[model samples]
Target: MPPRAIICPHCGKIIAGDESACSWCGTARSHPWWRLLKPTRDTARTDWVAPALLAANVVFFAVSLILNFVSHSGSILTPGNNVLLLLGASGTIPIDRYGRIWSLVSANYLHGGVLHLLFNMLALRQIGPWVVREFGASRMFVIYTVGGVFGYWVSYVAGVPLTVGASASLCGLIGALLYFGKNRGGNYGNAVYREVSGWVMSIFIFGIIVPGVNNWGHGGGLVGGIAMGMLLGYNEKRKETPVHRALALACGVITVAVLLRALYGVFPG
Candidate 1:
């Protein structure tokens, strides 16, 4: 049997399979077991925004649960409205009565219950990566921040007293997918369109059946995402530009600032 030639990942040079090191690059070659465990360059290069967002949601849920348990022992997995509001639930009251408008972004990280958190996180895990791939990580963050704020803003204007969760942002991702499908135009594009359309239908149908579902936020997010997707363009249609990165930076800064303010208000000195 012949030994297969090994490729040097660092310098991208062919090396003798039996050699311990790459003489060309003066780098040590990885062991076969290590090579098997290591991720491909593409996978290693993948963006972290989606996972970061997911972690933020989980952290907020854990905090909310802890606070609730401290206040009332029986309220374990499901937190009460008081704790949720303290953690920054969005609504007319938080936006109007208290002037805590930052709740719009903060609320995106909060959830009503374990099931609510699970559902939104699952949807985000499914849809967020697609947006990151199509629009780039920076553009994905902008769409999520702007779309969620717009959705919550619409809900506040429509007089919703309270709402929380990442569904609005997930819906924004869906809208981006829809835009991609509609503009790309091909078998793959058609398939994307069909899949996203099914998601939209499922969301609306679920909203109708759920007693506390915020349909307004979901609709506004979809519209916001579509508009952002059109304006920003996707990777296939156009490359990510400086403008998209700048907008994403602005969105991130504003979101972070607002959340800090909300936290300060909650735990004043």
Candidate 2:
């Protein structure tokens, strides 16, 4: 006879139903949080999530350039602050002056220059896959979106006037991978830790040398990423669940809505 199987709530691996503790992580099978999360159906594989994010960032940068050119403001390579603000660049200026707190989400897609977009996208391209592999695509998206928001929030609290870019969110991915490496604690884990640590050091140095870098956002993103990684767990400990998928979808929906609202502000009828 075949054994009955159930998923471990903590680690997210399937286990024999008869076991009292999850053999994978030793967590008790009977946890109550499932009742709190009545998420929608999520059976599909989530390969599209990273590509979609990359596309959004690139499209937003293109739009920013068009607006800057039309308005005769920032150069072709670098969009003006006005154009970025129109596209929902977040920080104290947008949040306080315009009362667009939602810009926190939109700003993740905006960038100051072509190089800014290129560097951030490259970083995302590298880290996004690693996160998807380790955390699952849904969890990866959730971490990325929330990390951007939290990082900007930190910068706002620190009184940064204006900011735009995906670096904060990229830092979040790095932080998550760092936590994964250290927590996993093996040859592969150590390798991930070392590589991510190099990123952290480079970012720190860049923030120090680059006068315009938002160090607050980078630091905040790192902190937020670590917190989310711990809270959400990972693939080895936990498989992607309906709740993770639902959260990612919710983040996507919110992002789209905010972008639309920003665009409406730009080209309102």
Candidate 3:
């Protein structure tokens, strides 16, 4: 294999793969489990993370749409409750009746309507880069996945019988940005806070006016994001660690498995 180059953790200098340690900072080139995280697919690259998420959501939405159409019923824009449930919509119904706790993860990829998908994807596009820049890609995903799960779990406890959308995960991004801005406390941080605060207000206000909006999910995701941001620590506060990378890899694997299971449930032959 060809020798690879790595950025030194201590000094941000490139370390040749053959080197035992960084010449500039004298930090060891490899940690105990550094190699385990070295090749973590595209998640290591922050630029690809947002687009990958967009694609995954679109793919799931397409599947949901097709299944709804296959049944010869359901609005073109708004899928039926039955279809959403089959595709892993999370709530009291799926959790209580079906005992599909895994829906909490899968539901983040499903959508109820065209507008629901578009709005959420657009929001994700806008917020994803900022979170990645501030928190690093790994932590951004952790915030999204964990925040979404916590959001749906809260809504389930609140007696929401059925729900499907990416807004819950987007709220997690918004929450992380909010924390990054408020806690960082600088010109850049304040700017982020001001921008994210507008989003927060807009989200709650829209939720108030729009019927069927899951404000509980949004609120829960927001809180979950804040908590995750604190616990994970953004780039400004700390660099991405092997632990962060491992957590992201775990979330990615678990998510793929759950989504595949959701697909299988729709076609169990």
Q: After superposition, how far is residue 112 of candidate 1 from its true place, in Å?
A: 0.5
Kindly give the stretch of ten consecutive residues in candidate 2 with the minimal lDDT sum. 35-44
Writing each residue's lDDT as its tens digit, candidate 1 over 1-269 gives 65667776433467787777666644456544223222233423676887889998998888888888888933678989988888899999887888888898998989888999998888877677667766888999999988898889888889999999898888787888899888876544666787789889999998999889999999988998999899889876687889888998898888778767666766688
**TM-scores, each model vs. reference:** 0.82, 0.83, 0.83
Model 2 has an lDDT value of 0.84
Alpha-carbon runs more than 4 Å astray in model 2? 1-46
lDDT of 3 by residue, 37-100 (tens): 1222233354567888999999999998898889865887778889999989999999999999
The worst-scoring run of ten residues by lDDT in candidate 3 lies at 33-42
lDDT of each: 0.80, 0.84, 0.85
Q: Which candidate is the best by lDDT?
A: 3
RMSD of 1: 8.0
TM-score of 1: 0.82
Worst 10 residues of 1 by lDDT: 32-41
Please list the residue runs of candidate 1 whose C-alpha ends up more than 4 Å from where it truly belongs after superposition.
1-44
- Per-residue lDDT of model 2, residues 1-269, tens digit only: 64577775434567685776566544455655432122112312445666789999999899998999899998978999999999899999999999999988888899999999999988887678768767888899999999999999999999999999998898898899899979976544666777789989999999999899999999999988998999999988888899988998999899899999999999998
lDDT of 2 at 68: 91
